[model samples]
Target chain A: MARLSPEVTALDTMPNSAATPGPTTLGEPTIDWDLSIRPVRELNQFLHDLAHNARPEMPHVRILHPNGRHNLAVGLQVPANIEILGHAGYFIAGMNQAAHITVDGNVGWSVAENMMSGIVRVKGCASECAGASAHGGLLVIEGDASSRCGISLKGGQIVVGGSVGHLSAFMAQAGTMVVCGDAGAALGDSLYEAVIYVRGSIHSLGADAREEPMQTDDLKTVADLLQRAAISADPQTFRRVASARQLYHWHAEAQY
Target chain B: MCGIVGLLVKKPELRRELGAWVSPMLDCMGSRGPDSAGLAVFAEAPSTDLLRYSLYDILAQDVWPTVLERWNANVDAAATLAAHGQQATLFSTTPSALGKDWLSNYFPHLHCFSVGHVIDLYKDIGHPRELIKKYRFAELAGTHAVGHTRMATESAVSPAHAHPFTSGEDFCLVHNGSLSNPHSIRRKLERRGIRFETDNDTEAACRFLEWRMSEGDSLEAAIHRGFAELDGFYTLLIGTATELVLVRDAFACKPAVAAETDDYVAISSEFQSLAHLPGIQQARVFEPAPEQIYRWHV
Candidate 1:
């Protein structure tokens, strides 16, 4: 694999420097890569190398002109902060651990699928399955999230400022999903041990998923998540939803 | 995966560059779809009363002479024909309804990709870039346009199975995902006397919209009804002579992005297609919500 020389000047000598915002002269300048000058494959390869290379401190990486390409910044395992300047395609930051990633534009499907830890934020809407099967971390979307936003989520906190599409949180094993706006049909279908809070109307709920009274603790959790997401919705108006536990254990006698 | 793109020029000054701008957008989506490609462009009609029909896969060396000879014998009207490759466009003063019926009966093998006063369709089985070069898409001028590059998940890779399916007069549709229940949907429409050109799933959706519009439902209403009826993942871009409509399925599994500026409204299956458009950096970009309909006048 080709490695970027350490002696290379950050952004001053980078190709397409005219389009880029220039190097991190004002802040911590660890690394800044522009996708406009290099293809997505090279970027992914560089990220892979960065995760494997041993260093004294985690590197701060900035990606520019993501342009809705798929599988970007996948499988990162470092304690770094990464910022994407434009929209990204499917699985923008999947299988991430100990990295903080932020997207200035929207993201395509499965923004943080199977993420083990860290934070991922989207300034714009996210496509379907925004955080599917993610086990840990905080995933935040300032805009709407499409269907199956947190399908089969094991553990995490997903906060969406806008509406969510159908069948979100379906079969989620353990997680907290907070929606500030309306939810589409069959929300939380066949849900398992996940809590959902919605401030707006739910089109429908899935089998074994029902609304529960929002306790004081639930309100506090929702409030904290909202603050972290930078959204200003009333926590008092939110409703809690969880699995009814009716399908937790199957019965052979019921099959007849 | 399939890629769909639409461009509606809001500024009259940019009208002539519609194809030039859209060609690059379509080319950027080459990786998403490599099986077949199609495009439909809307331009000024020669006459208000004349109806234009664009046909593909005519195959004959002298396509215009062969088609004109047969068509002129069937219909008595002032007509013009233009042919390139295996594709051809016909403009006739004959009533649109009568012309369509007669053409279907006489030219059963030819595919009428579009029928309208302002729309002309070009499509074939090849890569998007190759198709653009063959069709000289970048040089063609239009007011609005829609294009599709198909990956052929649901149908055979053939010229007849290519996208930009014409639904009603002055309207065409391009879809980026598969339908879960197209066979049943086709049966339902067939019972209603809606004819289908191919086994492609998106064609069923096109015909369904046509049937709904024929029953007096507006485009918005028909699309809403589609959300209730169709089962599957899809991001659809429907182009009419006067408007462009975008919609996503309730599941929103397929991806779509829209960018708008003072000059145009552009939609594509991914954002890279819109990144090269003029003033795109300042354009307001957003994902259309699931089951939500977005319409822009041309």
Candidate 2:
């Protein structure tokens, strides 16, 4: 339950701290293309180590990989800007915080699960549960988030620029979920406390959920989140759904 | 742990009878939580001063008036109106209540109060339809409600260990997922004289919300606070008399989906369950933002 620093670092001027002596741009943290690189795994390991030890003053970094590999930038928590030039598998930057991680290409499942703080932007479409059980951070999926994005979340914001698969937010405890497109079924089922804002027609509202009229306060909140997510929509156009407080007790007959 | 459903109409022009609309929606989600079922209705009472409480579980075939009198004396509740606009009666039965005839029997108590009906709780050892039929539940109704189907991960199976659990007056919660830091939070709450009935993580959530509400925070704000304090994977839905909220874990471990139509709003474990809902004009659905919250009001 460590709190992340609220200071935000820009995406340039990062340091290079790879284990291997690889080529690096002078002063700037971008990858040095001059050196003939080693195995993809070795290069990924070097880059991961570099990212973990990157200087705080340096704000930006870019890794250029010609081949698609597995487990790139695993456990990257450095407060710097990072970019991967090629595709990756499994967890890339899983549990990232502070660093603004950008994938130049596609990614595998669970891209940024358990992200405590900061932004993880996926440039391409992601696999299932892209940000599963993350806490206190912003995950921006440029494409669709597969099933269970932002499930069982404690806090933070996930803005999917596109649509999502089914059972998203299945057991979400608290956080704001904003889908620019349509959501799959059973959204917010057995939810404890959170707000869901959708701009399109809902397939169905789960049990204990009801449609609520938009008010000034609600509009303001939605507008703020849209601004942060870089989504453009009239706040008035969004419809909100939440639980109706009916099933709060078990009677003698209902007692099993 | 349980399934809950109900409807809320903001305008006086909206139809007052809620059973026809909310019942089907509740039944549709019966699979999410089957255990047991019960319904309660609340509205602008005819006599504003008379605080009428409808109790569902009482000694079977026993004198209800006597029980009510004793409960009133214990809690200092007085019978203000002998006969009023609509009689508020309590209905309860063992097993699950599902059939059409059994459901209709509960209609006698659902006069004017039948408007804002809420099947606030149900908990048992089986699926939703089985519990519904076993207990004769089609008669239940409500406008705003929340429910749950328990997988029984952290808590045991019992009526007390159900969703739509309450912590105080006007606060209810239904949760999916587990709470890792319940003991620390629970100890703090207990020190403040907050009593807890169940050992499940959902009650911890309810207590968290109640504490926030008691501290002068709105239900939505209290839920927001929970996002920071509560750890582990969880998808939570909270229901209050005036508002509804949904929160997703920061990692997005569980699943939840929602659809809003002009006439009806539906949420289910899968999108297929929402297929039967009518008049779907335009749907904009998405998952909750990791570690974020969504809230709406009536």
Best by TM-score: 1
In candidate 2 chain B, where is summed lDDT lowest over 10 consecutive residues?
A: B108-117
In the order shown, the candidates' DockQ scores are 0.56, 0.02
lDDT accuracy of residue B49 in candidate 2: 30
Candidate 1's residue-wise lDDT over B112-153, tens digit each? 887888998998988999999999999878788999998998
lDDT of 2 by residue, A106-170 (tens): 55567778888877887765656777777778877777777666667667677777776666666
Predicted chain A of candidate 1: TM-score: 0.88
Candidate 2 per-residue C-alpha lDDT over B233-292 given as tens digits, one digit per residue, 9 for 90 to 100:
777776665556677776555655555644444443433234333432244334355556
Q: Report, for all candidates in order, the number of backbone clashes.
A: 0, 120
In terms of lDDT, the poorest run of 10 residues in model 1 chain A is A1-10
- Give me the displacement of residue A130 in model 2, in angstroms: 8.6
